[model samples]
Target chain A: DVKVTQSSRYLVKRTGEKVFLECVQDMDHENMFWYRQDPGLGLRLIYFSYDVKMKEKGDIPEGYSVSREKKERFSLILESASTNQTSMYLCASSGRGLLDTEAFFGQGTRLTVV
Target chain B: TQLLEQSPQFLSIQEGENLTVYCNSSSVFSSLQWYRQEPGEGPVLLVTVVTGGEVKKLKRLTFQFGDARKDSSLHITAAQPGDTGLYLCAGHSSGTYKYIFGTGTRLKVLA
Candidate 1:
């Protein structure tokens, strides 16, 4: 089965700390994405990568960054964690095709910044 | 600004009841996907609709894509307690090619 594995299921970070959320996919999909989900806000895209060493900002990418140095690995970074950045972060992977393919998501990381 | 909007943010119904959730957007989508997320878990793909005015059924659940490809709906027949979860709709943006999710509909099926 295709799997997207998140490095952490839960995390606690101090304010102003640099945070890293890692994800790995077994499917070797060309597309990977990071999204933060909040109540009533659903899942908002933060960043996505179409290939290794390529990243694109999403709608809400102000405080977040992404790294895709390898084919199966994608990482989300918070430059300086803040209380407002506390949210459930999810990682997803999809095969090359966007129209017919489905994106498989990781279990998610619930981050709490204090 | 939300590109996709889902109506009835929350729904609660007894077992065996039917419910329909709507996802609306003004921007056209090449394809739309529906996902279900349980507590403490990420969303799981339930179905993907690519053609306009298309309908797909998965046992007790039915999905419909709008004729304009700008909207979609999910209908559940005889909902069960096991079907309780947060339902989300996602569609790729025209220029960005990134999927944007709707506000979501939280459904609680009481037995």
Candidate 2:
């Protein structure tokens, strides 16, 4: 079975603090993504990495960034955490091809910025 | 504008009741997927519909993709308590790796 492990389930941080949410997948997939889910906004993509050291900005990438140093790990970085950034962060991984491939998600990390 | 939108943002039904949730979009998609998410957990893929007008079944759940590939629906024959969760629809555009998720429908089933 494919497993995507998130480093943290809940986090509380002060304003202007830099936050790091880590994710690791054992499926050896090439496509990894970071998404923030809000109550009525649903899941909005923050960033996506198609290969190691490659990243692309998604819809709501204003205050977030991501790092993909290795094939199995992807990290979401909050440069300067703000109260508005408080939301559930999700990490997902999928195969290289888009067709017939389903993205698997890890247990989400709920961040609360005060 | 929201690329994908789901109707009936919240639904509560008795056990053994049948229900259907709709996900609609104006833009065409290469593929659409349905997911169920429990509280404090990430969403899990329930079904993926690729071809237009295609239907797939998983136990009591049935998923259908619209003929234009811009809409989809999920119908539960007889919902159980275990079926309570947030249902989300995600669409992937052609030549892109990113998926645009729908607003989501929160379903609650009571026994």
Candidate 3:
């Protein structure tokens, strides 16, 4: 079975603090994504990486940035956390295919900005 | 713009009942996917409908993609307590690698 691991399951940070969310996939997938899931909004993509060291901004990438140092790992960075940035963050990985392939997801990290 | 919209934000029903969730869109998609998410866990892939007017079944669950490829539906023949979760529909954005997910439907099946 393919596995996507998230660094933290729960986190609490003060306002204006920097935060890091890490995701690692063992499937050697070529695509990795970061999304924030809210109650009514579902999952909104924050960022996605198609290759190592290459990243692209998604719809809601204003307060977040991403880094993909290796093919197996992708990281989401919050430059400055705010109260409104608190949400359940999800990490997913997929192969280099069109829309037909399914994306494997990691257990989400619920972040709370105090 | 919300590319996809799911109807009935919340549903609570007794076990053995039947239900249907709809996912509609104005834009055409190469494929549409359905996922079920449990509390404290990531969303799990339930089914994917690619061809227009396609119908697929997984046991008691039935999925159909509209002929125009702009809509989809999921039907549960008999709901169980284990079926309680958030159901989401996602589609690959046209000419892009991004996926647009629908606002989820939260379902609760009571025993």
Candidate 4:
């Protein structure tokens, strides 16, 4: 069975504090993505990495950054957490082909920046 | 930016009712996928439709992709309370791994 594990299921931080959400996929897929999901907004991509150390900004990457030091691990960073940044963050991985687009996702990390 | 929109943002019905959720977009997609997400969990891929005007059925759930590849729909027959979830559609444009989810439809089937 394929698996994508998120470091935390829930986190609460104060404004201006740095935050990290970690994810690891045992599937070893080349494509990993970070997304923020809110009610009615669905899942909006924040960043995606196709290879280790290679990352691309997604549509909503303004307030977030990502790190991919290893192929199986992807981390999402919030330089300074803010109230508006509170949302459910999700990690996903997919194979490296156009047609191999089936993404397996982690359970998700719900973050609250107060 | 490619955008996918789903209609009937919220729906509530009793068990055994049939319903359909629509996902529409101006941007054409090479393939489309449907996902179901329960509360507090990540969305899971239910099905992927690649061909134009293609139809796929999973149990009582029916999925359809438009011939233009710009839209899709999911129909559930005799929905049970277990069918309650947030349904999302993802569109992957020509030769890209940039598939994005639709606005989403929240469905509630009461028993």
How far residue B102's Cα lies from its native spot in candidate 4, in Å, is 0.6
lDDT of 4 by residue, A21-111 (tens): 9999998799999999987567888999999999999988987889999999999999989999999999999887656857888999999
Report the Cα lDDT for residue A100, model 1.
33
Question: lDDT by residue for model 3 over A47-104, one digit each (tens)?
Answer: 9998999999898999898999999999999999999999999999988756436778
Better of 1 and 4 by DockQ: 4
Cα-lDDT of candidate 4: 0.91
Better of 1 and 2 by DockQ: 2
Off by over 4 Å in 4: none
Residue A86 lDDT in candidate 1: 97
RMSD of 2: 1.4
Q: Write the per-residue lDDT of candidate 1 for residues A1-114, one digit (tens) a residue.
A: 889999999999999999999999998798999999888677878999989999998878998888999999999999999999999999999877534357789999999999
lDDT of 1 by residue, B1-111 (tens): 538899789999999999999999998988889999999999999999988999999999999999999999999999999999999999865344477688899999999
Of candidates 4 and 2, the better by DockQ: 2
Candidate with top DockQ is: 2
Q: Which stretches of candidate 2 lie over 4 Å from their true place?
A: A98-100
For all predictions, the C-alpha RMSD in Å is 1.7, 1.4, 1.4, 1.2
i-RMS for every candidate = 2.0, 1.4, 1.7, 1.5
In candidate 3 chain B, where is summed lDDT lowest over 10 consecutive residues? B91-100
lDDT of 1 at B96: 48
Best to worst by DockQ, what's the order?
A: 2, 4, 3, 1
Q: Candidate 3 docking category?
A: medium
TM-score of chain A of each: 0.97, 0.96, 0.97, 0.96
Instruction: Work out the TM-score per prediction.
Output: 0.94, 0.95, 0.95, 0.96
